[model samples]
Target: MTDTNRTCFMKGQGAQPRRDRSQLPPRKMATLIIVLTMLFFLAAAHNAAAQPQKPQPERPLVFVPGILGSRLVDDNGTVIWGDRNSYLNFPKLEIAPSGPVTALHSDGRLVESINVLGPFWTIHQYDTLLHYLHSLGYIDNETLFVFAYDWRLSNFETAKQLQTFVDDPKRGRLQNGQFDLLSHSMGGIVSKLWMVKEGGAARVHKAIYMGTPFQGSMNAFETLSDGWGDFTNFIAGGLPTVRRVALSFPALYELLPTYDKCCRLGSPEKYTPLDVLDVATWRQRDWLPSEYRANGPRGAAFERGLSEARRVGELMRQPIPGVAQVMIAGDYFDTGLYLYVPTNRQSWRDWNFRRSKGDGTVPVWSAANNFSSIEGTEPSFQQHATIFADKYLQNKLERELLNTAPPPVKHDVLGEIDTPKHEKRRLDLARADLSPRIAEPGANATVTVAFEFETGVTRGDVQPTAQLLQRGAADAPITLVETTTDADLAVRRLTFAGSLVAPAVEDTYRIDINVAGQGDHAVFLTVLSAGRRQP
Candidate 1:
């Protein structure tokens, strides 16, 4: 059968048992009327469950977390804010331990702390994104479902688990009664692999991927090596060969080839098909991996994954069927300066680039489908700040998703420019200026900036955009100022006007301007003097 027909069939199957509230018996209706009359109620309750409720407010928001869905777990082994079968569930939150509970690895080892599992929302702690979204007014309580799963399982196995949970008769029902997926990084690949391999895609309505290396990551090889021990520890926490292969880098890369042969063919025995709504490319601090000097040297497998990721990228150049993909470029760098650590060997010199937004991990060009979409916005500067705790970043991202804004078009207008001569500069300039005189509380300041593109850059060649930020003042929540548009692909002039309210005091104010399109372009940014105000 056709993929479209299959999707329709699956949705119909899941939506069958809903009761018809409109077809009540005359006696039953009389009883209901009496109950409402006694309470002085004037309107009858609509049977939304029976009559295909709209996909809004209570829209299905499936959270496909990275790694082993550890973030959805609680101290008492409850699946807090996740699928029923997850390590923790919302109901279990009441009995879970509180006040500094340590997580026990699958192997029975107690971890004092795991930095990999962020402190605010660690592998064992849950609901950072959901809470942030709530504060942003994006979603109401109980509107999101965290699909937490063990990452140490093979793609095939992971797909099976997801399929079972989604296809379950009692669980997995949306307002409209269809599954929605939002997977990050490896989770995206696994979700797709399952849809095409294990026959799960037939049930999905939308699949949104954030910063997923659908093409693969060049650093995957190195990361996989380092992660082997961690994966071993996580997979029931042991060095079992079966567990090792599940997180194996080479094995993950081979999934594409395996599926192309199996399902892409025209056959009754083929797996389900993919119907993705949006694919978002997200990158923040720690997006890139540090090259470890300890690993005897890179291996052939690492090189192979890098090569394959690049190849996959080439394959994704064209759009897929029933799928519309958009790219999001974040240029809010907040990491420290690059601290160069030289190798101990006197004869050999290798440096450790310790800094925020390093190019090695996720370069700005690689973060989105088309960098030109955000010509003037700077990704390097965006990489400086991490969104681990910023409510503005958290809410803003969800807003973008809920709005369903199309990916920046090739000729989309970014914004206009107006700056003073004092902030202008020539080509070959490395650093720009952020005027201290314009100091304002991040939450209540109006910012205006000017940029001088090098002579080599033409107005039509590369689209340059600007980002204005207010750093943390004392201790206040970071707030994002209102703006005209999410991207600026065409700006022509010496000065630019970037008007937005300063973020909350928690964010330090700064200015970043990046060239998003083609051609060799260089520019300098200067924050025009402005008064700071408390709102």
Candidate 2:
């Protein structure tokens, strides 16, 4: 599973019913077919009515949501994390600056899954998906259920709780011991871990993952690396305080990018891909929580968190026997598929983004098991936040839920999944260079970029702009400067460049020459300590 190649053993399927019409005339055959279809449907209705299971023909459903999807509460049932006015309050989750780095708590438990944020702003989270399912005839607590767990804990704990919740006779345990699972984002990983690691496959019949990061996501890495500046996912809003609050969640680490060849070292034009999961990589980059780097229990806990992330990542790619899996991904928007990481192994900071097709969160390839299998949603330009509410995707979802759609066929066992080849397509990085790479924090640096476009993308669709964005999990990404792009015919490449004051901290930063509708090129600049030289 860690390698994304677990073979699922299919159980014997029940024989299909057959009917013969050759014995009747054409007119009678048509009449008989209609009559028989009506009778068959009536019988199904009757059985469903008489059955002890929920009155609907639909099987029981367990709905799990991604991290921050659930509301958190502490002792005395006081609201902790899921405040509707969280933007202003920024309810703190205490992570001692340095200590044992134990999973923080206050008699913590899941109060409910998050549905909306910024009550005044009326933002939506799971409300759209939940209401859509309700319209499709999923009854809450009867035919449908939501599993809410403290997202701060490891997925192992969450998965174990899932096993307990599903098997509990008073709750989700159905008469036939079967249910369909609908999970969004991080919940997909949680559900997968339970089905594969905790042996919940015996009960789950079908699992639909919507915008789930089965392979992992760059957004998660970005959020962890820099506090959440992802506006699409308002949970990680661009505020220094909010960024610090999100750093303590173990679930965030679990969501780190695990796909193959996800990142490269050095400048975008001259870089080499590296195995991003290697601990040494994180160590060398100083990506681990700096608070723990001084040597303490918290440091050990941080390493443990990474280890758990690798474990969950491996288990996520594994298949559960008898459990069918379908991934619904949004594939239209330019997503940051891979990154150009700074070669400065001195300290970890930013993941300079290079976009391709994705849900604006999880890349299409990442959602489709790194293109190891096909996904149900393809070429749909829907954003990740509103994907479940998309009408086209809703129809596909209804078909999948009723088992009416044909199961996705995997690529030839010995052959690879037909890659959405980028060799001759996609925005290509031609050249990106940075000058005066040496700077102390808070100094200015200049950048120049040259890029070519082979994709059919046009400027009308993406208003190409260049920005020097802030990095790290403890501050919002404030644009230091915003610039525009133009054609540099002399160089035969599209060019955009800008300069801005370096972050007023000693660390590695980047200069991004972003081309809208095309792609971006990132060149790193290490702002050294008072005296340290760039390696």
Candidate topping TM-score: 2
Give lDDT tens digits, candidate 2, residues 357-401: 677788888777766655344333345665675555666577667
Candidate 2, superposed: residue stretches over 4 Å from native = 1-57, 87-91, 95-119, 172-175, 230-245, 344-346, 372-380, 403-535
At residue 133, candidate 2 shows an lDDT of 81
lDDT of 1 by residue, 1-535 (tens): 9977877787888855445677898899899989979666323344443575322333456666554344344457543333323221212221111211223222211221222211111222225555554554444324565555644334555667777756555453443455556665556666666666665555565666554444333333333334333322342233232223322333344322111211111123432321110111101111122221123132333344334543444443444444333332332222122222222321111212222222223323334434334353223222211222232333334544453433333431122122232232232212223323233344233333333333423333323455543333342222222222213213322333334444433222334455332111111122222331211
lDDT of the candidates, in the order given: 0.36, 0.61
Clash pairs, candidate 2, are 2-314, 226-472, 226-473, 227-472, 227-473
Per-residue lDDT, model 2, residue 336, is 73
Q: Which portions of model 1 miss their true places by more than 4 Å? A: 1-55, 68-128, 135-142, 174-176, 219-320, 329-360, 364-473, 476-535
After TM-score superposition, the amount by which residue 144's alpha carbon in candidate 1 deviates from its true location, in angstroms, is 1.6
